[model samples]
Target: MFKKILIANRGEIACRVAATARRMAIQTVAVYSDADTHANHVRACDEAIHLGGSAPKDSYLRWEKILEAAKATGAQAIHPGYGFLSENEEFARACADAGLVFIGPPPSAIQAMGLKAESKQLMEKAGVPLVPGYHGSEQGPQLLQREADRIGYPVLIKASAGGGGKGMRAVDKAEDFAAALASCQREAINSFGDDAVLIEKYVQRPRHIEIQVFGDTHGNYVYLFERDCSVQRRHQKVLEEAPAPGMSETMRQQMGEAAVAAARAVKYVGAGTVEFIVEQREGGDMNFFFMEMNTRLQVEHPVTEAITGLDLVEWQLRVAAGEPLPAKQSELQIHGHAIEARICAENPDNGFLPATGTLAVYRKPLAHTSFQRSHLRIDDGVREGGQISPFYDSMIAKLIVHGATRAEALARLDAALAQMHIVGMATNVQFLRGVLRTESFSQAKLDTALIERERAVLFNQEPLGLPLAVAAAVAHTVLQEAEGAGRDPFDRRDGWRALGAAVRPFAFDFHGETHAAQLRYLHDGALYLQVGEVAGPLVIGRLPDGETEVEFNGRRHTLRVDELGGTAYIFGTQGATRITAIDRLAHAGDTQAEGGRLTAPMPGKVVSFAVKAGDKVSRGQALAVMEAMKMEHTIAAPADGTVEELLYVPGDQVAEGAELLRLAA
Candidate 1:
């Protein structure tokens, strides 16, 4: 095993690698950008080195700087933790040239699998099952459109050199093909510096299952089963699990063989994943076609680890140090089911827009990062007060759960997500809980389009139920009384007391709507609250689990309090939201823009314009494309309008909500 290794990445993955390296008695070095100088990964490593500026280009993506830091720290090997330079073939070759081992697939394998087009070609040559599409070298729009036509409508336009959902678009009709292709190509050029794209047949009801394959320098290889990554949004995975739901033993063996074939075709070394898109037909054929192969450890690798009882990072180190495969494929066994949900700092209600803020309070459930037998697990890198910056991926943590069966695992996932307490930034926790409660998902009927197809019912931001309003009122009363009762006689209690008059009604906003609530402090052991005709007094009970329980009418609700910038947030049966003590200056002015004109949603470079100064566009029509967080977002017209101004051109880097185009209603 290597004595010291450099983790050429940051954030949770870096920390994850460092933990495994430490367990194996290998010292770890961490590289960080200026923005991540105080990052969790840097604090976890044995040694740390500053890369460069805050932007990824200046730091994480600078291969030379990373190499220099690795050498200076005396790290014998470099582990590219999933992103940035993980799949960069040149960087892998550079590490090899510098006499440092790269704890990943060989540079030749990365080169062959890096480009989607070439990988597809290689898979086809190796007789691996491939989807019906065109991976040809043609770049002309007309030619690509012809290939799409040949493949069929509902074709996928994907960047040949793309990952993380960047430079990918699904066109359901021929008319929309041209615009989608142009937008995709522009994003491809900007993100990957390659405008090359390919056409693929879009599989309806597709389940994304990828096989985890490991290879050693002695040409021995074994597959670690597969992970079902069907739960996705905007072509990005939100949840994943090992031993795919509804998977048969026969299907698992077949996929294992096919994945091994694809890996062997490239003479793959170290860890890699062979992704396949399995189509669910009426007969349950389990026919899977090869997607591209990821030439590094996956973000969802923990699920595999939970099921297999193997440390993939330790294996990476041993293999890079000229060891053979740790165990034969036959010896490996799937102990139980494991599921992982990505907790991202994004607003699921607002089209899943990414949000950023200092984590005033961040607390994971008291579950272990790895479970024995069946339990909940969490893998994360952020802590209390960590900043969820916009310069990197919005993912804050990966919550994993294991159980004896799929049903149990799903239930644990729901519980863990509900137990998650995060403040200072919006999250998709409720959205994930909704997914778990979904009838189709609960029944193991999932597909790539599950999130998009069920988005409406799954993402409810309304505060409609009367019970929730009453609970909020009671919780509010408890907090108010807690603030008042604990003080001495000199403290003023009449913010709304008004010297023994009618109770003053106050409004509190939760889940985007205001609730009218009345509060009265009682001399009893509880605080009294009234909402319309409903009345209740909630008792605050301390729980053994370190979380407070709010009780009312023989029912108990767990509450987690988080304070951010003087604002108090209460999470529990009231769902999750900011709970201020009914602000004194409550009649705040509207934050909506004066003219109701549409603007950019985030800081990104404009890549496409569908309208000019005078073109008429309808509501929800694609008006422009903005690329941010390595993904493209199509900003649409808010309402039917005539374009009055073109505020930006292609390649203009604009701030969030900066005017991209003015549309006159």
Candidate 2:
């Protein structure tokens, strides 16, 4: 193995690669942008180099700068950690030209598999089952629309150059195809710098299953089973697992062999994933069609590792060093079930819109990050005070769990997600738990639309969330105050000298609704809380390890309470509830914004304005578009109105809720 290698990426994947490299006694170098100068990946490696500006264009994507840093650090190879330059064949070739090994597939393999159109053509020739669609080289909008009509509606338009749900849209009707295609093409250009696209049959009830394949310079190859990535939102996988539920060994072998064929067609080297979309039909019949091949390590590789008892990143390093296959195909076996949950810093209630903020309170379950069969692993790359940069992907960390069976894995995943607490921003911790509880997921009736299908239960507010959070918040305040007063005679606040109990009323704002709560400090060392006619005596105290224990409503519960910047957050078994604690003497005093103004939903760059001043628009008409975290969100009109003024032009950055235009009735 090489003495040192450079990780040409950031966030969890970069940190993940560093961990494996460290375990193998291979020193690693990390590259960072200005926004990530204090990032955990930089701290994970042995050496670090600063690139340029915060944006990817000015930094992470700058292949020349990355190569220079690798050479300056005397790095022998470069690992493109899943994104940025991972699939950029030119960068791979550049690394080869610079006399440094690229810890991925050969440049030719990346070239053949990078574009979905070409990859589909190659796979079709290789006799891999393919979905019926058009992957032809036609650039005209009318031509693409015509092909969609010829094939059918409910077609998937995807960027030929990239993945990760960007530059992809599914149109269910002919009328919506045009707009979806345009939006998809725009995203394609923005994300991959290629407007080229391919059409595929959008399989209803599709289960995303990808087989992990590995190859080396010795022409040796092996398939590491498969991962079921069916639970998704906005066409992106949210939860993934290995040794797919209800997978028969016969079908597994067929899919695995097909994936190997696709990989061998390109003479694939190193680690690669061959993705297939499996369609579930009536009477338990399933058919899988080739989707595309990811030419590098995957974000969900940990679940694969947990199940196979192997280190995939270590495999990449060794294969890049020209080592032969570690094990024969027949020797490889799936040991147990493993599940992975992608914890992202995004608001699941708001269409999974990305949220950016400083992580004021970041905590995780005590889990290992090794390939040691220890059951739980958390791969993260951000510190407590670090900001979730809008310039990069919004994923904060990955929670992986292993169990003896699928049911055990599901339970473990739910427990792990609840144990993972995050404050100072919105997360899908509870939402993920909700997914695990849903019948579709729990029963293994999986599909790409699993999240959308189970929207009601997943999006519903936790029962008594507001009141519980208020109680937790109040308990926290009371406990801290009582602790501080223990030393001062004049500040004795144990409800002893007071004639009546030391009762305090709290007013809190949860999302916008105000709630009234009363806390009575009792002489028995317990507190009584009254909210909305439900009065209960609460025995709340902070435990030795910072977890709060509360006995109320005839039940004992463990929770986490955090206060930061005037916001009180409680993380319980269900999920996180955020509320604001108001002063004792104050009213809510919250004002609602007028509906006459159209505003940006989140902080992002205004891509373009669909309406100018004096232009008439109907309700639900597109008014403008904004780009955040590399995805496009269109602002629409709330009512029939004429645009009175456009506040910002295209290319201007706007904060969340910043008025983008004035709409008049």
Candidate 3:
């Protein structure tokens, strides 16, 4: 076994690798950028080295800098945990030439499978099942359009070198092909530095299932199992599970064998995943087509670990050290069902737009050890004061749970999700809880359109849970004040005064609406409370666990309450409700819309403005493009207007809601 290694990534994956390396008694080195100077990953390893700027291009993507960091730290091997240089062929070759072991597949395998266009060609000859599409080298727009038409409408244009759901577009008709292709190519070049693409038939009802395949230097290969990654938004996975719910034993063997064959075709070594697009038919049958192969560890590998009770990262180190496979194909067996939810820092209510800010209130549930097969596990490297910038992926953490059955797994997942508390920025925790409760997901009728099909229930904005939260907040404040108060009248917070009865007013904002509550302290030591139209004699107390218990007219309610800064979080069986305490002394201003101003939706760099000043454009016309979090967002004209001014040119970073352009009616 190697004595030391360098992790060439950051965030959750970096910390994850360090954990395994520590367990194996291997010293680990971490590299960080300017933005992540105090990041958790930097503190995770045994030692650290500084990279360049915060941007990926200046830091993580700079292979030479990473190599030098490894050399300086005296790392024997380089573990490219997931993204960045994980699948870079040139980097792997460079590591080998520099006398450092690359803890992944050989450079030849990465080069062969790195590009989807060429990989499909390799798969076709290797007898792997492929979908009907175009993977040729022709770069002409007309040629690609003709190929799309040939493959029929509703085709997918994917980046030849793309992963993690970037640089992909779906065109339903020929008229939309050109614009979609251009957008896809731009994202491809930005994300993968390759403008080449491939066209394939987009399955209407598709479920993304990928097999976890591992190979060693001794020509030994095995497939651990499959994970269903169907629940998605914008072609990115939100939820993934191991031992696919409806997978038959026969199909499981077939897919596993096929995946192993693909690995063998590449003379593969180390950990890799072969993803397939499974078409769910009207009856019950399924047909899977080859999608692409990820040449590194997958983001959702925890679920596989939970089911198989295997350490994938440890396997990678052993394989790179020229060790044989740990277990044979027959020894590998699925133990139980596992589910993993990717918790991201984004607003599901706003088209899942990535949100960036300090993690003012970050919380997680109880975590089990890496080898602890069942229960809860949280993989993350973020802290309460950490900043989530637009320089990388928007994922905050991953919550994984295992159980004897899928129902139990789902129950545990939902409960664990409720335990997570996030503030200072928008997150999808509530959205993920809502998704778990949807009929399609609850009943296991999952598809890529599950979120869209159940939007009505998933996006329910009814403020029914606000009352408990309000009561909890009031109860907590009263309890805390009562503890520190003596006989002093001014220190008493029970609306006390020299008068007969004193009234205390409290206000909080929830979901853009402000609600007020009044508490009256009577001379008889009883309290009267009223929130909106609901009024009653209230009795409240604090539980030993710091939870608040409140009663209104003999109806008792217990809730978990936590306050950070001025934000109060209440978590109950109905999910979490965050309310901001309103400061009455602050100045109140008139709320009005700023018309004819085009603003950036989130913090990002301006890619380009399609229209300049004095140019007339129609409503919903593309006005500007903003790149953030490794994806490009198009800013469109709100109405028919003439462009008046451009606030920032291409490559200028803009804050969220910054005015990008001025439009005149």
Candidate 2 lDDT by residue in tens digits, 1-665: 89999999999898889988988999999999999999999999999999999999999999999999999999999999898999999999999999999999999999999999999999989999999999999878999999999889789999999799999999988999889988998888989999999998889888999999998888888899999999988888899999899899999999999999998999999999999999998988899999999998899999999988999998898889988888899898888899999999888888788999999888888898687466899998987888997788889999999999989988888878878878878888888888898899999999899888888898956644655777788777877777789566778655554455787777887878878888887756567898787789888888998878877666777888888876877877767677788775554364565678877888889988888899999999999989998889888898999999999988998888899999889
- Which pairs of residues collide in candidate 2? none
Model 3 lDDT tens row, 180-275: 999999999988999999999999888899999999998999999999999999899999998898999999999999999999999999999999
Query: Which wins on lDDT, candidate 1 or candidate 3?
Result: 3
Per-prediction TM-score to the true structure, in the order listed: 0.93, 0.96, 0.96
lDDT of 1 by residue, 1-665 (tens): 79999999998899899888877889999999988999999999999999899879999999999899988989999999998999999999999999899999999999999999999999988889999999989789998988898899899999999987888999999999998888788888877899899889999889999999998889888999999999999889998998898889999998899988988999999989999999999977778999899999999988898899888888888899999988998899998899999999888888888877788778777787542344877778899888987688889999989888888898788777767888888888878888877777888888988887787778765422544445644554545555556456446443334344334466665555566777565433335566666667656655565455666654666766555554556677435655544464745655554774777787767887888888988888888887766777888877888999887789888887787777778
Weakest lDDT window of 10 consecutive positions for candidate 2 = 584-593
Quote the RMSD, in angstroms, for model 1.
2.9
lDDT of 3 at 248: 97
lDDT at 169, model 2? 95
lDDT of each: 0.82, 0.88, 0.90
Clash totals, every prediction: 0, 0, 0
Root-mean-square deviation of candidate 3: 1.9
Model 1 spans > 4 angstroms off: 370-374, 461-470, 473-481, 484-488, 492-502, 521-528, 536-556, 563-568, 573-593, 612-617, 642-663
Q: After aligning candidate 3 to the native by TM-score, how far in Å is the CA of 90 from where it should be?
A: 0.2
For model 2, the superposed segments whose C-alpha errors exceed 4 Å read 489-497, 521-526, 584-595
